[model samples]
Target: MDSYDIIIVGGGPGGLTAGIYAGRQGTKNLILDKDLAGGIGREVPEMENYPGYENISGLKLTEIMKTQAEKNTEIHEFENVLNIEKNDDGFTVKTDKNEYLTKTVILATGSSHSHLNVPGEEEFLGRGVSYCATCDGLFFQSRDIIMVGGGNSALQEAIYLKNLGCNVTIVHRRDEFRAQKHLQNMVKAEGISVIYNATVEEIKGDMIVESVVLKDTKTEELSEMKTDGVFISVGYIPHTELAVQLGVNLDETGHIIVDKEQKTNVEYVYAIGDVCVGLKQWVVACGEGAVAATSAYHDIKQG
Candidate 1:
């Protein structure tokens, strides 16, 4: 077993930003991530909203942040935390491979892509259905595909696919898009077609995806459209199971409840980023991370 001043769960921008701040304050910290360090943000093809950079890929932004954080913090990738416990001294974090002790723990585990739960969706998960456009867009190069959702990611990824010579059709449950105006305009400018007030009923295929079945929200009519793949991006569910199990307070929607300082109900425990209640944005997450780290540093100094 090892010990540290701070332990951050999840390696998204929020966790990495926390590491940068904690490290600069001379706090011994460790960051644990289940898979790649970049989190879902890495899947974005282009990021125009993050400050300082006019245009940067999510992967590039994550890389730059990770590099700076590594100057002071230790990051362990591919480590899935199984459980966390609070004890008299501090905290204990158990991962699939090992365990560690830390005075404070920051929960930054982000959200995952939501599924349509329609028939054949499970059967064609890898064959023709995917949640990540950046990872699977190449597979459908020059082919037609369906994008589900009306969020920023859905539109952004649709634009990426369009640039790859693939025709894209976006299906949203509502007539209006929730994505930024710029992104919506971009999708239209790129000639991506949209299906509004529609929902997926099923994904039909032989071995691979052949088409998608859709239901009209207003009329309850069913229609089928041919496509090579379906990219789901409806919304995200926060990875808050661990935090909930640890007795952390959460909202009705399962987001961790936190204060302005990012402190959770549990002592020495904090929550930030997509896991907490707030607008799920990279900049917002990073700001929360900074606040959590600074709060933790001062709290430790007091004790």
Candidate 2:
């Protein structure tokens, strides 16, 4: 197996940023990822939070990051990672196509969006079902849409939808929302309807998402509600299976636990970005990638 000083997994903002830092430091590195880097941000239609750009498309941002990473670091695209095994000298990363041995590894694999497993949810994925509010909110302009979740993101997206002239209805399984007090109050005062203690049992439609079946969490009563589209705002789960198999420590939330240096519990192993147990965001992931790559450089050079 070919060996490199550092190998970064994921290829998103975190992975790309890590590659940049490592390449600048004159370290040989490789970036292995399955999809467009930048994680979920790639789907975001407009990104205003990231500095340097006023308003940018998520796909464009991903391309820019990918170009920078590819020019500086060797990248393996569209490779499905299967497992990671640690050896006496270093670690081995196994994928569908090839295997690589590296002295230091960075886990930048981000999280996956939580989506409904209903019939229409899968069949009509791009037709009606959406996950990113900033991405597909414009498609349902002035139309009625239903959001499923009670977290901060759900309320935030609900308000965003309402601002875009779409009638918003929030369906949550819990009677009380887990969102912040300020947002909860703001959405309520803004005329957003709340359907509490109800869960979506099925998403039904032939061409698009025509409606959803809601079952009461407490009373078990069922009702069919017609809507133009459905947004699943549930939380995310980390992409941490390979890390775990390699004896990396992952928290209860399925996120790899890392320190300020982005080093995991295992030696010569580091994890950065949303896959790690911390706030999940593009900016944060980029910062963590820098830290992990720098730390690995220092540690590897010292040894």
Candidate 3:
């Protein structure tokens, strides 16, 4: 058994930021992640909005943060936390490799991409349907692909696919995009076709994706479009299963509920970033991480 003043779950921007602050504050801290520290940030093709860098690759930005965080804290990778239980003192964190007792636990687990839940979508996951354009776009050069969603992720990934010599079509349930205006303009300028007010009803393919059945959101009409690939980028849902199992309060959407100080209902436990109630943004997550660390530092100091 190992013990620490703080144990942060997750290794994304939020978790790394919390680690840096907590470690710098003289708190004995450790960061545990199921995989590498980068999380989804690593999969992003480009990030133009992060402060201090006009533009940076998501992987590079994550590496910078991870380097900084590791300087003051121990990072345990490839350790998936299986369960968390409340104790008289604090909490017992059970991971695949070890158990950790901590005075404070910050849940920065972030989120996972939401699935389209359409038939053949799951059947063709590795064949011709994907969520990451950066990872799968190269496999589809010169092919027609359908990109789902109208958010920043969808728009950004569509631009990436367009650059890869693929004919890209963006399908959205709303007529207007939820992405930034600049991104919308960029998508149009890139000549990507947009199918507005539509939803993907089903994906059709035998061994691979060949077409998608779409429904008009406003009209009760259905149509089919043939494509070589399908990229579903609707959005993400917070990874809050551990928090939920431990009796932590959550919002209606399953996001961990946290106070301004990032403290959860359970004492000494905190939540931050996309797992909490707020706009999901990298900068916001970093800021919340800082706040959560400071809050933990104070709580531990007072004790």
Candidate 4:
């Protein structure tokens, strides 16, 4: 088996960013990813607040980072690591297609959104439907958009979308919101529309998302509302199957427990980005990736 100083799993922002940093430090870092290097960000339509430029497409941003990563480290594409093990020294990572050994492993697989699982939700993905508000909100400028969920992220994003000139509507299954009181007040003050005790029954559109059939929780009545796009922010599920199999400790919320430096409890192992228990965001993931790589570098240097 080929071995390296580090073997990173997941090729998204966190993993790819970490690869660049680790490779720069002269570490023979290798990256293995089930998906491409972009992760959810790549799937996003647009990204307007990623720093640097005023705006950039998620796919484009991913491509830039990916190109830099390729120059720094060796990348093994299309391999989904199924299991992990630790020996007296280094670690072993087994994927469906291959195996690898490395002194350090950084987990940056990221997480998947909690799907509505409703009819047409899957069918409308990318066709006037999305998950990241900051990523796809601009596409619906001046058009009505329905956001599912009433949490801070949802309400806040709705407010942001409103600022972007989109008529915003917030739909939640509960009559009352579970977000911070201030945020609830802000959404109300912003004149953003709210639909209470409602759940989207189905998304309908001929070519793109045109409207949604919403069902009232109390009356079971269904009604259709016109919209150009939909943003789902209900929740997310961490990509922790690999971490679980490797005996890494996870918080009650199922995110891998990491230190301030993004190092996991396991020696020479680390977790970063949304998969770890902490803030989840594009900038935060990049920061965490840098921290993880720096910590690993120091640890290896001392060893």
Candidate that beats the other on TM-score, 2 or 4, i.e. the better one? 2
Which predicted model would earn the best lDDT? 1
Score candidate 2 by TM-score against the native. Answer: 0.83
* lDDT tens digits by residue: candidate 3, 1-303: 888999999999899999999999998999999999978878788878888988787888998999899898999999999998889778899999999999889999989899989889889998999988888999999999999999999999999899999999999999899999989999989999999999999999887888899999999699999999999899898899899887899888888988899999988999988888999888999999999999999998897
* lDDT string, candidate 1, 1-303, tens digits: 799999999999999999999999999999999998889989989989999999999999999999998997999999999999888779989999999999999999999988888899999999989999889999999898999999998999999988988889999999999999999999879989999999999999999999999999999999999999999998899999889878999899989999999999998899999999999889999999999999999988887
Candidate 2, residues 5-65, lDDT tens digits: the string is 9989888889999999999999999999887566676765554567899877677988898
Per-residue CA lDDT of model 4 for 1-303, tens digit only, reads: 988888889888888889999999999999898877777777554454578967666779899999999999988878888988988678888899988888888999788889899988989999988888777878889898999997766876787788899999999999899877877887889999998999999999998998999999999999999989999988789999988877899989999999899988888889988898876678888888888998999998898
lDDT of 4 at 163: 84
- In candidate 2, which residue pairs get closer than 3 Å at backbone N, Cα or C atoms, i.e. clash? 12-37, 12-38, 13-38
Candidate 2 stretches with Cα past 4 Å from truth are 45-57, 117-120, 123-127, 132-143, 155-167, 174-197, 216-220
Pitting candidate 1 against candidate 2, the one with the higher TM-score is 1
The deviation in Å at residue 183 for candidate 3 is 0.9
lDDT score, candidate 1, position 255: 91
Please report, in order, the local distance difference test score of every candidate based on alpha carbons.
0.93, 0.86, 0.91, 0.86
- By lDDT, the better pick of 1 and 4 is 1
* Cα-lDDT of candidate 4: 0.86
lDDT score of residue 47 within candidate 2:
49
User: Candidate 3: worst 10 consecutive residues by lDDT?
Assistant: 38-47
* Error in Å for residue 194 of model 4: 4.7
lDDT of 2: 0.86
**C-alpha TM-score for every candidate:** 0.98, 0.83, 0.97, 0.76
